[model samples]
Target chain A: MSAPVVDLPAYEQARRIRDGELTAVGLLQATLKRTEAVEGQQPSSRPYALDAADLEKVHAFINRTEARALQRAEAIDAALAAGEPTGPLAGVPLAVKDNFCVQGTATTAGSKILENFISPYAATAVERLEQAGAVVVGKVNLDEFTFGSSNESSAFLPPVGNPWNPAHVPGGSSGGSTAAVAAGEASLSLGSDTAGSIRQPAAFCGVVGMKPTYGRVSRYGLIAFASSLDCVGPVARNITDTALMMNVIAGPDRRDATAANLAVPDYLAQLDSDLEGMRIGLSPDYFWLKIFDPTTGVLEEQPISPEIEKAVLEAAELLAGRGATIVEDVPMPNTHMGIPVYFVISRVEAASNLHRYDGVKYGFRYGEDTGDLTELYRKSRGAGFGLQPKLRILMGMYVSAEQYEKGYYERALQARTLIRQDFERAFDPEGQYGLDCLLTATTPTTAFKIGAVYGDSVLMQYADMLTVAANHAGVPGISIPAGLDRGGLPIGIQLLGPDFSESRLLQIGRAYERATEDASWRSIRPIVVRNLP
Target chain B: MTKLSGLQSFMQGSGQKDPASKKTESCFDRRTASRYNDCPEGEEVLLPQYPSRQDDEITPEIFDHLVDLAAFHLEPEEREYLRKELNAQLKAIRELEALDVSPEVPITSHGVPFKAAISAPLREDVIEACPEADDIVAGAPETELRYIVVPDIPHEELE
Candidate 1:
């Protein structure tokens, strides 16, 4: 029999449907069945006891749009029959990170504050994807207000479990988006990366995720999450599929002023291109952690996991064999400061953005019996938001307070300048490094057990350390699964390139994918997908 | 009611089997030890700390002020936990102070500079009616006659 429809790469899925070998409806049915098999239950605001199955299955979705997906799938097939042009994606199954508004769908941002709000118009990214004939399978879960590095902060618990091994977290705040694709629930997903929301989770879940340069994709209908840092991109099972998704979503839109008003390139055009003569830099700074020593009140540097470091080095070796020159000891001194800088910049923006969620406008509201407007605002905001949002809002207020602005907000912005300059120097042809890209481990370690590092806000923020600098620099980064660690957990290697160079990043990732096509690790499926009937 | 450990028990009934070997107090408890337990065993780690800040955090009075300014009505326990976490996070944010950044360093408000060539020009100021205005107004928690309704304003006269 043809390889299980759900297990095929997205490009293959689209081609099969377009070639008349697979009907869009039939493919969507198979996808739904696979999703049902791996997805235990839709997470919710109502507390429910978790069971053995819930622990083992990937809880990737907050809302399943099966009926809507079926209708869209049938329409695509009907269009094909009538000789009408269907978009390039044809009938591929797709999931959207809930932060992105899908018209008529509840865009929760995984926060109870938005739990009841329904979007009247779709996000530009979602609109483009649907226009490309990708069926919207469902809206996936995420950290509340996209505020946490792990999905544990989502009010709708239990948060998304890593598909590779459900006991662990699927990194966040795009946890559900990556987990859904990894588990074969969807061929592809649209995810946003702000301080590594998409790339970090994609790494943990053993999927290919790209955060195109900021402004590469329009953020028109995406609920704001650190607006200056937020970026929408694709999560897929393979490099080619990621490129396919990027080809459709990466472009300018009038709705988003930040979007680059430039011609979009065909991401698929450069796949399989040689990395020959390309200079890829390796920075020692990416291989460790810098934290404050409580006693001295000074920063301390600690090295990363030897296994993860080995995976990145091995990826470099493999690329070297593919004709790429590896430059060593490239100093990204400011890399260690990404999370610290992000802590201030992101919260200030988050606090400002969330201010729009008052009781008077759309979204969750407090009791009608409130005595006055101020009381109504307090009750609604307190009742609607989960712990993470409250924490961010309070922190944002404290940092941006008149007395603290220069010490925190403006300083963080300047720190951001230094972070950006680090990339500029490394990528500058006139500079000593002159590197086209930098290769590093996507995260400090592989996926950690669910709840392992969730409660500690400080520890949780560090999860994005390796991936956030790219966000700070407005560069594109792709996380590709390199190999499995000793625990049989997937390890990801990241490739970060200069601004607006998503095509080059994808080309590099595609080279790695092609080089490791027959590698034993590539054959290993996620635990949730392994025994599915 | 003490603050949550960096590690937590599966109160959600995640059905995670108890480990053959459990550490003191909790399965993955390392608050006092370090917060990097997620790293491979024996991986040297240094978790962020701020002894002075922890001892003399601005959280007590400032935190309450912040909570009110943010307009949240947090429960006492929740407030305590949030306050502690916020203090811990602030300690971490304090790391930015180490950079010898000067006023001359141009602040990067957005990562990629929005050059005039690549940046979209401002949209013309036009009164384009939102086709979904009614839909949006109707989405409010409480609305009447296309206006979002709320409790009494409780205004006071200026001195």
Candidate 2:
């Protein structure tokens, strides 16, 4: 039908290869060819203007690990030829978010600071994926150190474009992770979600992305942004593949003391697509948007786009038809405070984590002779980090400063408590609403054109307000494509559940996916792939 | 930097150009500084001072102190843009002040209630010698025989 090799889902690809119907190497070839066809020139450090020819195509990868991928693919093909047992993901190509350390690839977190820095050890997620027989195709682009809501903040220029239409942004800092999957360059991706990094981009790129419960996945090798808010998760073309990815990546690791010790659930096994008795919530707090008026320095109340609200309402109807109980007007009063709390909490943690990037380490350092260590530190960081990371460091220092900690830092943490409490109350089983999950629109609006809201950090952060609550509450949320808007841009709906509820989220997501499979928009392909032979 | 009359008590030693200087030209190149979004060196911006009850909206003086403490030598344009955004975000973060959180609300470092029961058990602290010492050192920007090299650490004589 649509190119037998690359068009199939991750599980299908693995099955085809594992069953000897397709060679792993042959599938790898098709994947590489598709990547070459769709992915334009790899993005470069900002201020280094891209060629005009490079602007229209999807710039998904920051660096491709073709050599290593070929080796893994060949090994799998050999393992299959010898009649040996193969892993469930025997031939699935994986695009890792640049923040995750992959041994052979230069894992720049879409920043120039780590342009040449290669990790000697891979992240536990990457390690587990490879052990489960997934091939690492390359490192994808992201917001530098996962700082911004859009990929535009990446020091690497020509920010990751939405696969649906490259002129638009593929919401970020895991923009490239979702873009690759949507463009069919990779069947699966490992994207870290800190404050909606994975879910927002996946929603923008029209792919399935999930943020597992905090500590559900090991953060041992992820380049830290806001550690408490960050969750390493999966990005894929379908719910099943997302589940397949979660099965491998979601587990405890001794290296990360914060990793949950509970047994990892087989996410694939839980995707029964049965929504019977599930209580899905609808909060009025989420339907409204808090628009930050830069001119007035105040957050103004506004309704989200009519199209997005309709999508959420329609999704509630569809799930209701599938036997899920719909709970409306759930009062999540503190939901509106997600971004405000995130600003203080994420910044302080970002500031603390970024302290390790001194010049003497593996990453970029000032090249010139320095008079002292302080001078070295200033010049290296000033030169190495982009505006956003520097901005974060400055904010972190200011808020956490001795004089300001009580008012800003500690106060934000307490506010975060209220946001968490909102979820706790809703999911408390014995509480009033007792929502098994909250169903809402993934983003306030559909993917916007590149450069639309990049410079205004406050405006950009608001794009994540609908999704940031899950990050704040350390709950798991999944974003799945609902339908296309009048602009032909994809609309995404999200489902958020309490701790260790990834399986149920995936199950609900799979049910929605099955329901939408026969829709007319489902037949549409990304413009980048529509004309390709 | 114009020294705030009361700021010298805690904020000092930020090598700022005097605000009263008759020289109109900035130490930073105007043309290059203007390329960034806002806040060229000499251009002054003032906003309402509001720690609400405590007079702590980030002023130029406080911004300078934060820049120095963060060990960042920002371009004049960057300084302007960052300071503007920082204050703007601080305004948004003021949403926290309106919250009715009392002193008794325990803070959560993470969303999941990470009781020790669910946390990874600590592994035995056995000294397994690292075999990749050479490999780890190879990543340093400057290195000497098995040691990471750096510029001299400067110190001043004690008074």
Candidate 3:
């Protein structure tokens, strides 16, 4: 058989193969070979894909769906061959991040904490994609409990390395999903975003990822992390793929209390909308807050990259050229407290939500503690949680301390109210600074060398700084490939919309994406650094 | 004066060092002290409330008093919100303050409820295989018996 189809989008390859231009067995073989070559190249590290016997088992499972997938593919091919019709992602093979519970598959969320855990039911989002006939390859990796911004927090698995620059981190806790899509291992992967888990990796790996409005999609089976901030979204090779996936997965679930009780819009159906009359706000103050205090009119030391600033300015112009009213003089309130506020709120929720991992009812349990039960709990937690998770737990616990209540927890809550109010006032039609969507740079800087996050606190801090406000405000933020930096690493232009206004955000992104012809920004990727043990 | 271990006495006697010792001490009498040791302090204790100033210090014992004070003075909505905030903060402290639970009872940590519904469908009896097993296994550092293996855990640790 021709080697498994390697290095192509699953949908594209599947369609071509089904039309007699490619073969499924050949594609599987090539993918296996590529995975093997990648493994051999890094003899010291874990492999990126499963093995020969596992492949056989996988094939045996695929064999059950292979007939149906092939029939559907053939039908699509027949339609295409006869000048009939097909869906955009018809016959594509994709995978959902393990945070999503696919029927019968263990949804581990990348922690040994729940390695043996299986979902008796499929998540509503996964079910939607399955209904659309996307063949799920397998659950990808992630941070434990989707807790860390980097994939390293995973309790059971190694960090998901960026495919191009294996040494640099693939942004996480959706790092594996981003890596899988970027490395051509999967065409589309669904990952949860809380505090930029999806967008950060998308920027790092040079892929397209979207964090839809909170409650836009159901969280029925998503293992909770900061419930109010978590959102299930798509990561794909490009914006179109992201939009296509969004169309399938965006909706409400009766079981999810927080899910928005609104009708799901056809995301792809409106992809071609023009931004001619739309107003896109370029918040110079919001973008430059790290440097300047516009209210005080003083320059500061937040040292932003000249490279990124230039690209963002150009992105605004590009949108303006596409018939959009680009307003650059608009100012939003300072978001200086966003990161701190996000940490407190997220930790508080995390502290409360994560109390379930106690080895009593589920997952890993330690019986080694013959000591007092309290010590057993502390030791179990100290042993079970990774550094990041522990840090958050500690931070949350500290803030929630009785004496510290008003000083920290309530203060953080009040700060969140102020941030939300700022967003509301900015987007208010009758307010002083009314605007449609607020645009800002996704990252202060481009992808650095992998492992750099361990050293540079500011770099790591600013990584999610741009995305956290939306999480705090409970609004939608979309990150589009803006323009590349001097080093050719991709830069993302982030657009924030009023709550429940994801449709407008996507429209604005699509318009600008169409206007920009910077193909190089899309082509260049991260520098790979491989580590094998 | 009830008989107690050194640690218990150290904890109980430590509170007498505070200024409100007389008011706090009498309440910690034999019957109350026994129940208070394991009981959550926020829900169980009562004391003279701290002043309504936002920045006032809140001890574990003072929290219950604060709640009562809030109930007496604030509007219903205001009291409810403050109660939630206070209770949440107290619960976090209590988790830390709680002496280790016994080995038979695991210290519950993660708040995620990972339960499958009783009415949930059963897994198909026929084994379903992985389509990307080769791709997945390609990344495993070590493998044996078709499973991605790792350094063996010391069997005795059991957690």
Candidate 4:
């Protein structure tokens, strides 16, 4: 009778609403119904439990904004009825990661410190999305302070399970955002990336995630993990949806000093553009033949998982076949140093940023056990913070200490300069190695079993090794579903370009997606969504 | 072995053994004795418990000092866990020290210096009341009427 509720791409749903072929109320109801059906249910288990008990099992949403969402949907419908102009993403239902502030909603960022913290103001990105007529459904879970790679680091909420296999993890700290999209709970979602938080989770949940060039989106209200590395971006089912979100949220904001003032390109317009003569760089040192061992803390020099290597090679070949040249061995010698550099900078900044939450101004306070002002400060933070955040704070303190500042913190900053130069060298047309974009695997492996990498912090940190370099260089990178592993987990390949080259990256990505549309590997709908009634 | 006897024997052995021999024997004996104390005589010790106290840059004492410096109050177990975790991270950070970075290389605090980009102009600062100031203050745990209530500061500590 009406358009099928589940699995409808964001663009199509928006179009139907825009055309008045489907009412916003009907779309909202259908999306909510579908979300209720599949949000918390384990897809692998038989006999679908449509009961209220099962709904409670869904850990994806930290706070569901049903009333607000319905109200917003009604307003959009009313606007269209009055013959008013609507933005491109009108009537689209989207999820916001809990890290981004949404006024009147609890924005915990998955930490107990902010467990009851209500955002008094919305992030610039959230405000823009809502202004573009997208309805905010809920806030999703993430790692506490976005410190750990796994969503298990969430102290206040249950770890978000991968929709692909409930036994495995939805990669984090943007796990719930990606999981919400993959499970069809939300048509599209917003996530902040500070070293692979967005792309890794999107890869795990089998969705498209883009970390725009640093400063591309305003950080006005997005919770900071690493101020230098953090970039707010979108997670969606397809490139078009991601681009639509970019259209609304990208460009400089007067509120955020770091927001780039570059002209916002129409990402959708460049989707159908030709890729002829586009040079894609491949770094053998960074991408080829390496498997990280959690047990020994070693990144072994062995052939990468055949599936991942095959996916990258095939994508390169596909681009080359479509008139783009594949350039080999672009040197990024300092790429491996990104992890340590990022660790130093991010932790130091986090230590400084988190100092604001010391019980007096806002968020959690622990004055009960206070013997002095300092005790109150200590107890408040110590009691409020989770394991990973505590550890990181200590690490930040160690590196930034006056004694170790020059050797650890200062040297890391210097190394960051070298890393930035490496990317510049690759992108410079007049320089030795000129390239349009670089290609690499998003994760070393597919979504791992939950608790597999949980206990090992080093192993968890290594999850961002492939993705963090882009953040360090402040470049734009997108993770597109390349294929699936034998276990049917999604494998993603990332395309990295110089600063403000998001349009070019999206163009190359769209070309690859189109070429592989008929292929079995294009997009994988998680079993949870596929099994929905 | 009985707990008291184990302690007694360990103390007596340390006193009786020559200092030179004790150095070598303590390495093996302390590990063996600690392992043996945890298990029955016949039970195999899968892995010996090596004392974490070694010639390391980050020791428990230094870790506590750092925790104090950071103004974090970790519980005993949290401190021990972080002592190990921080050491591991520090080991990884030490690798950066090995890099041949010249002192002349400019430090990059932010990824892209948007201030340098002509298009990204700085906003003019203006004095204005925050609309949500009350809402933000309301979110705090302790507030007196309209103001946030904080612990009284000892004036000497401030100095």
Candidate 5:
């Protein structure tokens, strides 16, 4: 059966809208309605009466800007009626992760500290998307301060469940962004990755998430987590749509000094490029053997699950069959250092960035509860910040502290440099193992049950094990749905490219999508979409 | 002095000493008495139940110090949980120390730095009105005519 209008891919929806087959307003209304159906409202008269089962299926958004969305859609329609040239993404309904400020919307960042904070200005990336005529349906949820790998850390909202199975988590801290796209609530989403926030969740939710090379997309107005590693990128159902979304938001911005001054390329132009003559690297060391089990707190020399390994190997073989050379067992010696390096660096930056919410200005405040200024500072943060953020802050403070800086923080940074050099060695055309891109399982496993890793802080932290290397190396990474596990949960294969190799990454991802289309692998929609309320 | 000890001394020195009583009182609360049992005139006054850490392990005392350093007012249970979490993180971070990274490898504190050849255009330093100035203060819990009002500092603490 054909999918519902709301469930169509973003590019298809945009195409239909442009061809007069669909109106931007109709698409927005359908998307908003689907969103409301999935994220059912709590009964205001008796908020406590909401059923646990109902709450489990709900909560992909922190706040919905329906009025603004409809207004934007109407404007798009009016412009189309006037025969004015609309931008590439005209009439597409998208979701912005709450961390990205959207003017006139409550951008809580899934934290109580910013629960009531309305952004006075929108993020530059969001502005670019809106200017391209994409109607933002709402601000989606995320881990509070974007700290946790699971959505459980969000203090102000319900946990975002996986669309594949409501009982499972939609990997995080961009869980809601991925879940929204997977559940057909939003055609596309903008998610930030500071150590795999975008890719991990996309892997879990069976959607495409791209973390562009660091500074490739402007980080202006994006709530800073780890300034050096953070990137704003797109999450959608397919690579073409992701490429299209990237085209609009990838340019440099003067507002963000870190944004690369390099010219943005036309991503869609190379979407159909074949994998012929390309060399794809497969690292047996990291991807297959030496999996770290956070639950047991042990790093073992066992292979990954059969299904995940098969899917990754098949992806490599598929490319090989298409004339690309599959370079096997390219040793990434320092691959094990990704988690530790990311942990130290991210925590340090998170501690620094989160200091802005001291209750002295726009966010939550506790001055009224205390007569002392220091007490106000402490209490406001104590009451407003969640446990996960507090943990990260403490870790950050501890590492960056005088005693531990050399052994932990500085060493981690140096270790990060080594990790980047590892990738550089693999990507160097003149080196022994020159590669176009490296392929691996986006996550070690498919979406785990919700709360599975929530209680285990180590397990939660290790969820970014496979994806953090890209962020640490400041290269681009993309997660595309490869196949399904035994339980029918979607599995994703990741492709990591050298810095500014987004066009090549998209080209390979699109080629894989085409190769798998005949097997219905690329078309596997989450059960949530089929059973949308 | 070691940075941690230096910070500890700074924080210890900044404590509000009761001038008349010649005792160091609790810096966080005036209602509470001195945190130290035997008060010395000039020696460092440490909290009796300060969460202590050994080497890399983030002990309860060290965790508490970290909380204060980060200005996070965590509850007792939350503090305990974080104490454990921080220790685990520190343990995990030890993996990085195990790696054979040469001292010559420059630290990548920031992701790959911008190209040295490409000079970034500088914006002129000119004062301009903030369009969101009113909206910025709108979310404050308490506000005066046009400014966010924070709690008043204690006179003795200020001095």
Candidate 6:
């Protein structure tokens, strides 16, 4: 029999099954078989590439989840037949990033440190999605503790390759979520962004990733990196799926004191609303910053590629043509200070947060005979943590101590204050160019060669400069695949808005996506082969 | 006042000493005491008698007031360090006693700094399920499922 489907959204897949046009068992088996066949072939495609250990782990979950899937499917069918409660996402199968805890599943957060740890409860985001009848396939990979901008920082796996080019990186820490959505491993996925964790990867993998305003979504079950910066959102194949997932995840939760008590809006319904009077602040300041050293004085030292800028600028013009007011000179905050402040605060928090992981009451331990507790701690931490983790821990330790705390840590906090003030001042102004949202490049360039950044700390450091500020300031941001390079790799445009501004941002982003007439995102290919000898 | 710890006194002298005042101190002066009493014999020879910020303006009464104010927030180690720093400043000021001093010499303070507002939002106290603790533990080279086994500390090695 022919494979059950191709390029179908989650809601449509569920609808097909509801109408008896497709069987859940048949679809599941087809997916497993397709995954297996792809594995047997050992292909060099982007989306098809799956780590041996991770693939096995996810397959095991799939096997174990068969009964659960059947039970859920039958319930859905019964509901459809009996005219019972039917949610918009009823019976849809999905995957979620490992950063989110699902009860009965081991949420690894894509780190080896949490290898055997099982979350005792579900993340509020996951709980709501499941409550809406979405069947979670499994947890996806991510950067360790959501720290690095690239998935390569993961202690457990090499970075997820882009779905378009296996040789290129899937920008991360939400790489796995975006990859899953683009590759059709899941109809939709959930990911968290502290910096560009969600958007960067979404842009790289040619999918949609949303980071709702800082307090718009509850961060109850998501692990902390920089608490002030972190936000959880959805990744999906298109604008509608992204909205669907966002509707389920965004809301006030008592579990997270930071969660805003505002009423959740109908994100999907807001898509078609006219944005004729909306003002988008296009900061030329973003393009002027020296992200990378310039080879020539004539050309500004931009981290973004020329083609990528062309795509974004063209889109900006298109937005202007669509009756939106696009002003170019509007400046961003002290964006250059983002990296330093982010590093200090994030590392300081990381050091304190990871302190709980010392081989003790719970987790992996290290040490054999006759030594002190200090030695135990040193050895256990040394052994459990990866190099990046160690570097951050040391950096954080240095910043938190009495000596450097005054100069580095305190200064960073001061800078953060100035940056926040700058943002407030920019947004609070009235008239000609009152800011509804700020626009910028999601990533400086398209996905680069895999293992390319292995030895380059400068490149790695610059990887997050553009996106880190939004995280530091605790604002909402989203990334949509704007266009493609000659290599066919996708470029993303980032839209950052004030706190609690996701619904409007989504509406704006949806209009841009539809108006662009770009379909390079759909060209992303999943790994069709695995298990190479 | 509490006695300053050896480490505290050393740290205070190390950071707070003014180089300008060190040139005037006679090492042989009868009343000029050393802050390096805790230093090893060879190390004590290298200790410089740099001046403190204390003078007639920094009286014992003022010292007591500063100490009381600081006690609320200072850690024991910090208090000891601060006590030494205050004492050093007082001594340095008094070194000017032999010289014809003018009342017009302006005194400066430990500089107070301020930044813009908006403290970090406090994380919710509610405990949500995190990644499996055991999974994190599994990566340890030597660990029991929960606790990291360790060797006993020998008392002789205590610093």
State which candidate, 5 or 6, has the greater TM-score: 5
| Docking quality tier of model 2 | acceptable
Expressed as tens digits, the lDDT of each residue in A148-213 for candidate 1 is 876877878767889888878898999999999998889999999998888889888999999999
DockQ of 5: 0.20
* lDDT (Cα, tens digit) per residue for candidate 5, span A1-533: 77899888788998899889999999998887787777754211111221347435747887788888989999999999899988999999899998999888888887778877888998999999999999999888888888888776776444777777776678888999999998888999999998899999998898999999998998888998888889999999888899999999998787887888788889999888777889999998656444343334455554555677889999888888777899998988777788888888888888998988888777778635586888888888988887788878877887888987898888998988888988999999999888999999887777765433453455567678789988889989999988887676778889998988999999999989887889866556676666553
Q: Which candidate leads the pack in lDDT?
A: 1
Where model 1 places Cα greater than 4 Å from the true spot, the runs are A48-50, B1-54
Instruction: Provide DockQ values for all models, in the order shown.
Output: 0.37, 0.26, 0.02, 0.21, 0.20, 0.04
Clashing residue pairs in candidate 4 are none
lDDT of 6 at B95: 17
- When sorted by TM-score, best at the front, the candidate numbers are 1, 2, 5, 4, 6, 3
Off by over 4 Å in 3: A1-88, A291-301, A367-379, A455-459, A523-533, B1-159
Model 4 stretches with alpha carbons more than 4 Å out: A1-3, A41-58, A289-302, A367-369, A522-524, B1-51, B157-159
lDDT score, candidate 3, position A334: 40
Chain B structural similarity as TM-score, candidate 1? 0.65
* Candidate 5 CA-lDDT value: 0.78
For residues A457-510, write the lDDT of model 2, one tens digit per residue.
Answer: 665677788889889899999999988877677889999999999899998888
Chain B alone vs. reference chain B, TM-score for every model? 0.65, 0.62, 0.21, 0.58, 0.56, 0.25
Instruction: Please give the range of 10 consecutive residues that has the lowest summed lDDT in model 1 chain A.
Output: A46-55
Instruction: Name the regions of candidate 5 deviating beyond 4 angstroms.
Output: A41-51, A55-58, A289-299, B1-56, B117-119, B155-159
Indicate the docking level reached by candidate 4. Answer: incorrect
Interface RMSD of each: 6.0, 10.9, 21.8, 13.5, 14.0, 20.6
For candidate 5, the iRMS in Å is: 14.0
Q: Which candidate is the best by TM-score?
A: 1
* lDDT of every model, 2 decimals: 0.83, 0.80, 0.57, 0.76, 0.78, 0.60
Error (Å) of candidate 4 at residue A497 is 0.2
DockQ of 6: 0.04
